[model samples]
Target chain A: MTTPTSRPDPRPAVTMSVGRDKHSHYSYRDFFRFNREQGTIIDWNNTQNLLLSEDFIVGLQTGLEREVGDASAAVMYTIGIDWGKRDAAHFSQWYEREYGVGVKQSNLLFLLETWWWPFTAQGWGKWEVETESKQKGFLFINLFDSMVARTLGDVGKPVCHLYAGLFAGFFTTMTSKELSCIEIQCYAMGETYCKFLLGGQERIDAANFWISEGASAREIARRLHQE
Target chain B: MNSMFAELLQNAEGRYLHPDELESLRAYVEGIPKRVRIYQVLHSKESVLLDRVMEKFQPTLPHLTRRHGILAWERCRRDLGMVWRYCCMAMLLNDEDYLRDKLLYWLETILKSFKMRDECRPAYKLMLDSLASIFTAEESEIIRPYLLLAKTMLVG
Candidate 1:
């Protein structure tokens, strides 16, 4: 929790930029403020957040499995969906207030990136939203360093149901449409990263069936014409 | 720099910045042009810089072929380019946390997944060497911290 200081940087500020964001380059200092005296971590949008440990995540997942058995994935997904929906509502309010633009009026890619930055700061890992084939009824979201997959180890199955549900929930609330998301590929399944397919329930269910039939992520993308 | 000013302003809600704070502000203000200049050079020749680093890195990872998954040079191209973008942004922001929070952690995971941790040391050196070849000693000095951070996070 370093306080803001105007002391001459002992070292030269050797940063290089490409003229993007000219004066408003996003920085964590402005975004995640740690107030030690108050013992609080407040984000740019003034949201209070926690720094959850790997052990806590692992324990929560395993505990759910023990309590609900095979339904743990579903439970996680449900939680993510609920969390996502809430985040959308929360995000819209802050976003409009901060940017002086309604969420609906903002550029799509910019809007999504702005929405996800806080999540990245919160250690949910980073993501790429592939909208090349969004018109075909679905899109691919590539997630790297998924907190769940990294902590749970490789269990030979998709371990990002929570992310799937989170995307599912967030999109549903934002779009005012019923949408579903499925983790088509996962790091826990020995992939380099996690990939989620977001689309209508039918598409997600079809992807689920394809996974049950041993379809790879590439195959799923091909079937969906996402390539 | 922006947040620092914001903090000073917040503190000034009742009282003005004292001598110490003004002196601090002078230091940060003087460094802004240097950062912007570094960014200008790096941004103008980013493609050339990236290609140079790749050219230098090629012989080191000989076993990694384009046909190989993450081990391939092709994969490195994309990730390396991405790293460069963030590095430039981080440097321009003149903030180390900008690099770590925004990109390095995610990149470390991606690298580990590809089992390319061994690539960091040489890559870091090569990038530094490339920067040295391109910029003056003073310029390279400023860029070194961010590169060092990338090396540490990706490999250590």
Candidate 2:
């Protein structure tokens, strides 16, 4: 009826004007369902959830440390990796169902924000993801109020190995690449928040060496940028 | 509209909201008429608004166009489009912190990282001023604070 006045649309049109619910795509209220009468907690993806106490979460680490000694970090990390990989499948499923977009097709940063919101909603923490360096084969995640680190507090070393493992495992499964994550800085180490470096195995190896040599997150970032 | 009503009922803990929390619900309802109008206007007239912004922008910041080439207009339009969308979303949600936490923080980092800050800061102000032509004072009041909120976060 009329000449097309604009260039080809760069993105999906804003469909909110056409009777979409303000929260149709999602909302915190709808993301999780709690049935007090039935004593059940179910998420949008129909996954069952457990409510954990801070005492239990802290005791979890102490108990692990008591049982396995210094290897507790590795044990926690292994659990995180497995947990993350499992979540990836669940993430991909609901992600497709909710948005009608495949994981790979959407912009990674946007997809990542969507992915992390559930974690944030579940009280894991709020996080900022840096992808400006993604083209250089790696990225950084800054996590505030890490459930593990916040509860453990000021132990003077990277105490978020589970977080690092979770990141590594999630990305590895999502990308189908052998990616790994290293805790470059942590709140428990007297930093304000935790910082993680996610990349391929080679990069993770280099970071492992650097950490052993006492390099800071900033130092590790600089070296990675140089490479 | 249903979401707001649903929100009036459902909460994270499977419990009803306190009467005090409904204060925000009430505000969201009051702003709905203006928010819906602004959202429709922004959606339908996106290109026109972008062109109007460019009309002022190209003449004022001639150096950026030359430095960046013709593609800069595309990038500028996309940036302004994104900014306004965030503004509209924040207005609709009636959550004052939505724009800052969701978009401006990310936008600021990208602009600064690419050395686009000095040039882009003025555009944000221009973006706000360009809306004066269409939005009435009543509509402007609904939108202005958010645009300024964005400007406060990014321009400064």
Candidate 3:
């Protein structure tokens, strides 16, 4: 860490019409700090200080696999679920403060988009939820340009366990129900885009089994509905 | 120049920063204008500078556009605007400590990759020149030292 310094003050202060806190909104600009002398970035806020280094992310995902062997996906899922729960609790506070405690009264799609805006800012790329099937105990999330999968490339398997865990965790808190999520299609698996299915653990487990049994995303959905 | 500001530049002995100057730095940062005259000048110069920047990065345009889509230039513009805001804030604050912290923060967290770091220097240099062009002779004299300090923070 570099130390702070004092410098020569320039011209006398002039008054401007800008709001004092007008620039205080959470922006990607506030995401990090710069150290001029050391030529490095320092994390800013405590809660929002996570860095977006693709190398670090790739290393972490593969590092977990090296350390835990076959169970790394499960471990990643568990971490993501916990992250989602904590994020939800923090998010709800902000949401309530900004929009009031009216999650139900808010437009559902708009609310979900609001929830996702920060992630987009953080370079997680754009995402959309399949609204019609959300009430049927299952929701589909289409992720365009997943940073994780894009970084890792076409690895030939469903590799977005972090996203799966995040969706599962987010929905579990929002709906007040135990939800599990799994990625049925992944960019790593040579898919054009990444897709996830969020629902009860039983439904997710069935999908996971089908995934292992060589079922396509559409086939998994069709087979699940027919059950 | 204030005594506090003088002490900050002196303390930039190599890469090590002294921790004691934080309080003065905070006060200085708090005093910066939310919007500055430089921002308006830079805002008007943005389009031309962006085009120049895009042309400079034309080699990587295909890959960047493929990954980030056709709005790559737009995204770069938005980020440049954001960074310029921070730079203006640092200029107003006029403390090496404040500028250093603010600059490092942006580079590390926001521009977390090498590709952005590579493009940032030339883009900022162009912006500085553009801002300087709009200054009167006397105004240029007054703003030069502070602006130069900001430039140093960016390039370093």
By lDDT, the best candidate is 1
lDDT of 3 by residue, A1-227 (tens): 11112232111132323322232233444444444554444322223234557888789888999999889999988888887887777667656656666676655665676566567656787786775576578878999899889999988987888888888898899889999999999999999999999999889989988888899999987886676
RMSD of 2: 9.4
Question: Least lDDT summed over 10 consecutive residues: which range in candidate 1 chain A?
Answer: A1-10
Best by TM-score: 2
Q: Write the per-residue lDDT of candidate 2 for residues A10-67, one digit (tens) a residue.
A: 1123222322222222344445556675675655456666788889878998999999
CA error at residue B132 for candidate 3, angstroms: 38
DockQ for all candidate structures vs. native:
0.04, 0.15, 0.03
Give the runs in model 2 whose Cα sits over 4 Å from its true position.
A1-27, A132-137, B1-127, B131-139, B150-156
Model 1 pairs in collision: A6-B24, A15-B91, A15-B92, A16-B39, A16-B92, A17-B39
Query: Each candidate's fnat, in order?
Result: 0.00, 0.00, 0.00
The Cα error of candidate 2 at residue A23, in Å, is 7.5
Q: What's the ranking of the predictions by TM-score, best on top?
A: 2, 1, 3
Give me the iRMSD of candidate 3, please.
10.1
Candidate ordering by lDDT (highest first): 1, 2, 3
Q: What lDDT does model 1 reach?
A: 0.77
Model 2 iRMSD vs. native:
7.1
TM-score of each: 0.59, 0.65, 0.51
